[model samples]
Target: MQSFLQVKHVIDYSKMTHIHLRDFYASLNKKPQPERVKMLLNYLIEDQRRIEKILSTFEAVSEPYILDSWMQYVSNVDIHGLINNQKIKADISLDEITELAVKFGEVLVNFYREAATKTDLEKVSNIFKNLAEMEVKDNLKQARAALFEEM
Candidate 1:
């Protein structure tokens, strides 16, 4: 069984991943790019910021018992490796950037799903499931917005 600390560590890592992604998008925005691409980058940066805030709120308001709960299993998701694998370039195409953002969201969704299933506690499981759902919805919205921009 994994300790509560382990779960907290994963949550912290996820939060940090969003920060890194936000910074990456912000850097891309600073570079010379098509106006549409710049707009997309701005949306992505704001989305990441929103997600980071949500995670921070969860950390702040979670009950002590819920935070201390143990998990029966934990997946071996390599979040650090996933973050490091991003190959963003200043000259990246609009489609490429959109796809990359979707990929990042998908990774988080999978991670949350796995974490949800590994826990026996209903509250903990629900929290993870809810997070996964949020990511899925956000990804779809982002993809749709990009499609409209392309059209």
Candidate 2:
């Protein structure tokens, strides 16, 4: 916790940007409707675009490794791959998948921040911090929507 707080000082994160980062992964499961799947994909694409824009914005920076790494993570996700082999006729509840995503979020949030702090370049550290914050905000949006769906 202390490490994250310390590392977070490297970048300016938009706390107001509530993104639904987890929804796309969660929608891969059997619980969400097909439309939900579409929504997830759209959000995912939007995030990708955001990352790209951020990268382009800082292309002139001396060290953009952190932004590069984040783009790799986003680009590496197998979007077409199905998350579950079993075909369920019913929609899977948000509760079923949120926990897994939240757990991943917790780990990633810490990992990126720690990684940033270890970087020698200030620009790299700042990008990592931004990436971490973006991930958190995006994931939280999904978690929130899921909770709303539950209600």
Candidate 3:
């Protein structure tokens, strides 16, 4: 049986995700293919919107000082590994890009869900649970969009 330990580790992945999305967006922006660039720009915009939602959640329950400190703890985490293992390129098909984006969302959901389960504080757990649920909803929206594109 697994034991629940009182771990006070709170990771703020907002900065990391922003940087990752910016880097990916920049790469896509440089591509010669207009259609691909447009597709990725749309993806990036939606990603930014979702990140804002997560940040808003934190704002609702956390002080500026605590949130600032949590942001600084990004170095302690291997966040890039959690997002996606694939190197995104502009040449990739829309389906491939969608798959990669979905994978990133999945990782976010899994990370938050795990954190929610591991935390000793109800408030912290609930925050993480909410984040996970948001990610799930975002994934469903992406799936629906993909389905529409297929039709």
Best candidate per lDDT, number?
A: 1
Write the residue-wise lDDT of candidate 3 on 48-146 in tens digits.
Answer: 666766676656677554433221112333456544455656576657756866877776787677767654557666767887897789788776666
Misplaced by over 4 Å in model 3 are 1-11, 34-37, 60-77, 82-85
* Stretches > 4 Å off in candidate 2: 1-91
Per-candidate TM equals: 0.88, 0.48, 0.69
- What residue pairs are clashing in model 1? none
lDDT (10s digit) by residue, model 2, range 5-89: 2222223222111123333443453343656544544444465457546644555453444434332112122212322332343
Point out the worst 10-residue segment of candidate 2 by lDDT. 71-80
Instruction: Output the TM-score of candidate 3.
Output: 0.69
Query: By descending lDDT, how would the candidates be arranged?
Result: 1, 3, 2
Candidate 2, lDDT over the whole model: 0.48
TM-score head-to-head 2 vs 3, winner: 3
Model 3, 97: alpha-carbon shift in Å? Answer: 0.6
Candidate 2 vs 3: which has more lDDT: 3
What lDDT score is found at residue 43 in candidate 2? 49
* lDDT of candidate model 3 versus the reference: 0.60
Which candidate, 1 or 2, has the higher lDDT? 1
Q: What are the per-model numbers of colliding residue pairs? A: 0, 4, 0
